[model samples]
Target chain A: MRPVRISQIYLGLLLALLLYLLPWGGFGLLVRPDFILLVLLYWLIRSPHLCNIGTAWMMGMLVDLAEGGLFGQHAIAYIVAAFLAVVYQRRVTLFNRWQQAGYVFGLLLIAQTVLLILKLFSGGELPGLAYYLSSISGILLWQLVIYSKIKVTGDKELG
Target chain B: MAQPQQPTAFFVRGPSPFARLIFFFALSIVLMAVDARLHYLTEVRQGFATMLYPLEVVASSPIRLYRYVTGYFSGQTTLMRENGQLHLQLTRESVELQQLITTQNENAHLRSLLEVRQKLHYPTKLAEITHIGRDPFVHKVDVNIGSQQGVMAGQAVVDGAGVIGQVTRVYPFSSEITMITDKSLAIPIQVERNGLRAIAFGHGRDETLYVPYLPANVDIRAGDKLITSGIDGTYPENLAIANVKHIDRDPDSPFARIVCTPAAGTDRYRQVLIITAPPAVPQIETEPPATIRKPSRHAPRQD
Candidate 1:
């Protein structure tokens, strides 16, 4: 694999943003995974120097606006998740693919949990266990990408 | 293999992770407060959203293409069968509609003879669904028509079947319709059988509407239909809103929990009509009504 370029990262983020904008409703909307956060986390874990918590925070703000929800709800959740990813960035480099998936799963759950709590605080009804299913779906998507041989970080470092 | 650059690992050069976290957390908290409490960020959000419009269209293009392709390849026999069914149904409905039109004319003439006011003809505009709401959490969507198409806030959105929702926000080329399933929306309805007026709120958990605060003894039955009462002046009178699905009278709860599925698919239809009449905005007067000592219980519902 070659070195990851800034342009590639930009393209990935832009595609993720588009996916985030697609009209979703019905059961799909309820179970829709956080696409932008998933992409941000992939980049954050793969190249911490290229994408950071600040970047995640900004994207979260965009999600907030698009969702027409209380602003900073997703921003805070994403920033917290990004901070955790950054703290363990080097360790993530040491982990093999499954371990990385596990870590990513944890990060995704943390973000969703934080969001759920914030929503409850704002008088939203308890959305039940199904609300967390999206994280599972998101992690499954991540694993699919890994198995497809689309390396998040270039494989040169692994070699 | 080439060696990695020494300074490339300068991840620690910026503020420490903890400091950055604190800074971002504080900033997000402030932003959340401003957005939630201040009502100052609507225009800012709309501007940025308008900018993101192109990307949205691009993202939705594949789905549109898939729908078109599938529709094209659909079996010809099935199409012919559906066409035949529709033609038969149309012929049957046309006879009934003609009779109803004659009755309506006779009723209007009778009302005029009695010096009664004429019923207003409601105008509606067609709008196609651009996409379902991108956020699964929010019950809203972008319609193909917008402010340029004379779409305005508070206009009722309906489908061929019945009421779907209301246009809450209008952009240049598209407008946002908050589905009746959205928690923020409430529609005034009259029970079709008895004409008892009540408000229906969207049950956030599912695609259902709830009529709360009705006494357990309220005169409503299962399978009863709810129609727009036109008390609010936003929705016109007699549009089918929902059908009473379940009426739970549990001993534990004080109010009867009446749940009804919306007559219109809350978020399912591909096309809807935006009723063109703008909602009449209530004006503030010099004195509030209570001081005049008007009876509250028998307050008249007005047009």
Candidate 2:
């Protein structure tokens, strides 16, 4: 019913990128959440008219560049996640808060699994279970966002 | 933003998500293939990395501020103790330096007598580590110096204690150092005591290195220090690397599994020196053969 300004989408993505660029190290790095993906998912659910699959691909490209990794690895992973988010965008808005969190958590896991599969194909060593710790942290961060924004106008947009 | 063409449509306003996913996936695969198999994207990657530098700076600023604050508030007693230890270290190192200078002069005279070429003295520049590698799987660090400052890829990086890593990628204002603990790095090293040469490779998952394919009865032992042999032009000879931490010579396997801990505090130190040594092989390649026999095996010194 309400219009989300186009600039707001870009600003949200930019802020997420800044968060992703934080200088994490050692154990901190192990549990760092994927900020860009969380923001992308948020926008995909709230304003699919603007932040669609292409935005995901572009953000993934930027992430790939910053990561100094295989150029398109994140692109594929993000696109896969974005596809799922966009496909279920309408249904997601009607779900209860707990179901919505589960749905978003599932999306994060899917994205990570895609990335992990690509890493394995590229001859990378199989990481331990700690590798999935990022997904858990990401879901927790997503819930934090929900809790922070739910009382305000974010309620209608979040569901 | 435009209103949905179909007023009744809730999520049917855009192109098929399946088509978008398939198209993007294919494009990404092609890009990955090009990046992994070819060198054309190197310059492109460097350009993007340079563009991303500002954000990296902004992101790391908080940690920088925290470090500065902690340093400012550090106890005076601790500072004084550290200063006293440094003074003692300087005094002891100066005595060793005096002896080293005398030996170096004598060695130069002997080299001239034998007409051997003078050893190359590499110039090194100090740099600060700005951040750890973003990817936990990759053992790398970004140092605050780059091509603009004469830092080049393939140059060896060291700390005060020992060798840490090599410069793997150079951007406009910073460079990435792939530490010796990465799977992609291998260094030619020799035992300091017996001069037994072998190659050491990084154990990918952990902060350690291993010497693979060595025989079971190899002369290597626990606590033997490994130093650069300088067979490779990338590093200077005789720099301390890792110490043999354990040797697992299983009866079932023919090769000894030698694990080592790097001498340098690669994770602990934030500053490093990048040795910008000139490439040595090209000079030797340009010269005519002095002797016909064993021409290919020619080294700076006779074996």
Candidate 3:
């Protein structure tokens, strides 16, 4: 019911970045969710005026730098996903909680699919289906956050 | 009755979401092109990596603390057992070392008589692995030692067992070492049994090295030990690299499919030695007319 604060959004993004920077290895890395993207999507859907496509693009660039991959691969993926979320932002606010979760899942999958195509184009080998594990885990984390009373939409019930 | 307030139209958001997406998408494509093909963003990458160093350390601190705590609480009996094994190994090696010293003295005398070059001794620095690479597709590790410790890119990294990797990127206080299993890394190796030399390339999708371009009839077999050939000048001569694991000879193909398992603990070891001093560059002679003439004379006879 309260308006989102700019500082809170930034603090959340920073915490997500820290989580992304953790020294994850082996099986942990395989299942590690894209914390930054999940947080970005939360703010983008909840407070589009504060976090727009440009913000997602910048966050994706930071991830690309951290992962040491091609400079703009994650950036492009995030922009595309952010754009999709923005186009359907009003519709998302009207959906019920379950429907909203499904929509968020689609957005996460879209980001990953874009990244996979970019990686393949740049001579990277096709990874196993386990590559999509991050997306699944990301959606689970989103549901966990929503269940904990952290609103991600304008309507409290949907959030 | 309440009067309706006029809505403000002047304070509109700058652009449509689609417009913003297109702008960012074009920017990203340009950046990717410049980064992948032109490599114009190396400095930008390095700067960001340096800025992210503190966060990296903070993230890794938990693992470091766990290791320290476990080590401190390790049982005395386990320590004693390790000490006893090390003492026994030292005594066994001392006997061999004594023989080696005598042989070295004899070798020096023979080398002087033959007017040969002195053997080189490389100086090495020890480094601890900080983290495995974040990307699963790349086989790299971050080490604690970096440029501040005089660590440089392209230095050979070896564990006690054998060659593990080479330093590919150096930050101020950390460096990234690409392991022998990384797709981009290639090592010049010699088959220890028959001195057959070949270039081994890392497989992209797996933890294996491929020795391509070698003919199917090549004498290499499974279990053949591979050591650094030293022709590339990056790795020192005769360090254990890998052992042949599988050899598939296709009748239709000209090359044999040779796969090898790295001798060093590619996924196991935490400490490694980075050879700091590069091998001496051999002098190139400007004049070798006699050698050129002999090769030319033999060329026609072989034809």
Candidate 4:
């Protein structure tokens, strides 16, 4: 398998940020996936040496700035998720595609739950159940990427 | 195909993942505290927003192009129909405008004679909404105009219907409006019918405003219109704000639970007018009448 280039990872993260910056409105905004987090997670799981907790925290800070919410909410959430992913990186690579997807889904949920808690602490009201829809959509997107034969785990390592 | 085995790292990275996590987590908590408590990061936020302008433009281009195309392809019949309706409305309003001019002239003469403060004519600039706020929980919108266009923070934004919001943050080329339905916004309002004044707060989870702290037996009723009292000096005087929807008066509770539907299109409109003038400060009379010295029970409601 070809080694993943550091430039490619950075470019992918940038593209995800741009997608996040899109002018989503109405129902689209409610269900929009956390594109930057998903990309950061993918890199952390696939190429941990290249992208680590600091990278995730930086991206999370960017998200927080863009969101215009409580300043560090997304930063802490992303770092926590990144930590989980890094700690279980090897176990996740050994799993089958479905198991890996489930693990990623769990990480997404953890990120969201942390964010929700932070928001509540900041006096934000509880949003409806639709808040979790983004996690579901994110996992679905991950599945689509896997189906397209872009292995999240390094192919040579899997073999 | 032969693959190379993973090589052990010769040099250690700066810190372990957990240690780095702890450091970043603590840093984030400090940032959150500073931002929420002191609000010392306004310039930081504005600088980042300005840096993000190019990406925002790229992100919004698709919608802008779509709007341009659709506007270009609009049918001639629809245009003619709209034009005719506007013409008829203009003619009807012209009659009312003539009367308004005569009344304004008379009011000016009377105010001069009585040595009263002149009414301020606030200048307004029109702005187009660029995007709705990304966070669904916050009721805010980004408008195209900004400091470059003389848009300032705390200016009142309104549409043809009524007040929409106030400018909360201004960038170089854009500004953010925190809508009347946002959790942090509160507007001083007066009931149109009985002249009772109260403060209306936004319900965070919904698009309604709540008039809390009013006594259960307050004169406010369902369907009563609430207009800006202008006592707060943020919103203009007597502009429509909301219509009281539901008033829940529970026997156990001391305050009335009043829900109001906003008068403006809180989520629908694409254009609004920004009133740019700062609010006029009320003048204090030098000589006080003995009768007026004592506060009347209805004094607060007079404004």
Candidate 5:
């Protein structure tokens, strides 16, 4: 019923980070969605004033460190995604839940695609279709969060 | 009638998103350049990662607890069977151990005769896999021990069977191991039969390695074993790396596409050893000069 504070967004980001830190291996790792970006996007769309590109960039660096990959790779991707989300924040309020879901899906893919491009430039091998599966799963997660009554700032409230 | 309204949330003054994007983008570029080119961020990354170590432990505890509980409840029969198998294996290896002792002594005597330097012994620390790579596309695993346990980057990681990977990042309480399946990984290897040397790269998707750029007529066959050659000094000599699974040579291509399945027990082993020594850094030599003697105005070279 109330606008979320900046601190709450930070707390959520930290929680997402913790999730990222959880030990996963084998098939479970192959399917692990990008939790930090998911939360960042959620907050960016819901409360742009609370979380912004800077936060997203910081989280991306953490991911780069965690994955032990090229520095700023994830940071760059997250900031780009956050920029799109912030730019579209006002318009997303006009859309229905499904439309917002589509927008979020696009954002996730954009982040992953940017990361894939950077990785390829660094001489990484082609990871194939499975690399994009995370974005789909991330969208599913966004939808679940939306349906669970955790409101994004723009979702219309019915009387 | 409503009283005069206060300014709404939208009226708040702040930097525009475009400006913020440019600022962060510029900052990230600098960071990426420094991190990629300069290697200046190691200490910074390590300190922050150490600070986040507790959160990592907290987040992983629940999953670990669940696994422990499930294993405890269902492990009785499997444990008994495993115990039986191990007893048989122990009996088999015990016989081999005697032979190994004699062979080791003979090898030592021969090496002494040849005046060869003794191989450096590496101490190892056992660490459990705390988590897999934070990003799905990257192949890495976090081990429970880190700098606190003296883990250093580039230390080879191995499970019970064979090499798994190497430590690429080390935090305070934990370290990240890039699995041999990761695309960025490359290990120097030798064919067991002919001792031919080549580098094996991670296949990026499957748990396999690819020995590309080998000539089509290369003397490698399917089922050929691959092992660490030790020339690079990152991995010890003779550790089983992989076994050749398939070889595809297209008439159009210059090199054969060789695929090999990793021999490491990534699927079965939870605990792995981290070799403590850093891989040896090779010395660099500078070229002497274009001319043997420069024409100094004041001096002439002696013939």
Candidate 6:
């Protein structure tokens, strides 16, 4: 009925961060979705004014710290992804729900690719295909949230 | 820091996404260079990690609760069986301990006879594995104790069985250990049977350590036990490290590819002992010259 509030956007991001902090090891860690990025993307779509590329960058810094890798790895990735999400945001209105899912999947992939390049630059070995499993699970989670939103609002809009 | 705002009315209220991207991207690149090359961010990282400690505890609470519940509801028979097994093991190890004591004393006596330096026993602090699998590309685990408990980076970690890893990062409340099976860690080791020394390096995956640079004709064999050589001064002498599992001596290659399984149950063991880093070794006191020497270089010619 009303537009999403900025507080709600922050609350979602906080919850996603907590999820990211959870101790998911081994197989679970391999498939654990990038929860923070998903939440940031959702808010960037729903309320670009409240959650913009800057918000995305800050979240990325937090994720990078939590992950304990080289600083700015996740920040760079999120910047690229958030920039794409905002650039095509207008076109999002024309695309259908499935196409929207595909678009978000591509964004997640780009983010992961950027992170991978940074990782390789830092003398890290090439990871196996399973390294990209997180993006797959991340998009699945995005679709799940989208489906829930449609069910709750009874609307056909991408936003 | 006044950030740029959107100059024109648009769908969004902030600066154009492109401008924001360029700004953050440049900032991040600088951060990455500083963090990866200069390594000036450890204090910053530690401060943030300490702030995140409470959230980490909260996040890990579910697993802790699961463990607690299982421990509480454990069958009495299971406990009794475990207790029985431990007692048996204790008795078995006590016999070995008696033999080891005699050997240590004899070795000390012989060293004293030879005027060799006495070996020092290192003190250890027990820590619980708070979490495992930190860097995805690296084999790392975080323990409950940190600098507050005198756990410093470069300290060797071990279990009752054998070497576990080394503390690489120390925060206020927790420390990160880079396991010997990580690509970045290497342990100086010697074969138990032959005393042949080599360095074992982590292969980055499959939980295997490989001993490289050994000539193909070296006397190493499959199933040979490897122990810490102690030359590195970090790990004490004679601690179990691994058992050689495979050795490939190809004719084309001069060196053997020796892979070994770590002796410690790193995946299952939750409790580990962190051996404090050895203090700066005392400089050996040298006898001073009766008179101050001068122009030694010119006077060194013997007729």
lDDT of 4 by residue, B1-303 (tens): 223323344343678888999999999999999999999998898899888888889988988999999999999999999999999999999999999999999999999999997877778999999889988889999999999999989999999999999999899899999999999999899999999999999997788999999999999889999999887777878899999999999999998999999999988889999998876566678898887788788767765
Candidate order by decreasing DockQ: 2, 4, 1, 3, 6, 5
State the lDDT at A22 in candidate 4: 90
Error of 3 at A121 (Å): 2.4
Candidate 6 per-residue lDDT over residues B101-198, each given as its tens digit: 99999999999999998987789999999877645667889889999989888989999889988999999999999999998899989999999988
Clashing pairs in 1: none
Q: Give each model's clash number.
A: 0, 1, 0, 0, 3, 0
The CAPRI quality class of candidate 1 comes to medium
Please give the CA lDDT of all the candidate structures: 0.83, 0.89, 0.87, 0.89, 0.83, 0.85
Q: Which stretches of model 3 miss by more than 4 angstroms? A: A154-159, B1-12, B279-303
Give lDDT: candidate 1, residue A130.
84
Worst 10 residues of 6 chain B by lDDT: B1-10
Q: Write the per-residue lDDT of candidate 2 for residues A1-159, one digit (tens) a residue.
A: 356677877888999898888988899999999999998998888877678999999999999999888899999999999999989887887777788889999999999999999999987888899999999999998887567742112356554
Off by over 4 Å in 6: A150-154, A157-159, B1-9, B279-303
i-RMSD of model 6 (Å, 1 decimal): 5.3
Candidate 5 per-residue lDDT, tens place, B1-303, comes to 222323256743588888988998888788878988899998988887777777877988898899889988887889999999999999999999999999988988999999997767778898998776666666777888988778888899987788999998778788889888778899999999999999999877777899988998899999999999998979988999999999998899889999999999765677999988877776666876768756788776578
Model 3: per-residue Cα lDDT at residue A4:
67
DockQ of each: 0.56, 0.63, 0.56, 0.58, 0.47, 0.53
Better of 3 and 5 by DockQ: 3
Cα distance off (Å), candidate 4, residue A154: 5.7
Residues A97-118, candidate 6, lDDT per residue (tens digit)? 7877888899999999999999
Candidate 3 per-residue lDDT, tens place, A1-159, comes to 466677888889989988988888888888899898899988887767778999999999998877877899999999999999888877786677788889999999999999999999997888999999998999899887667667665445653
Clashing pairs in 2: A93-A159
| Candidate 5 residue spans exceeding 4 A from truth | A153-159, B1-7, B113-121, B277-303
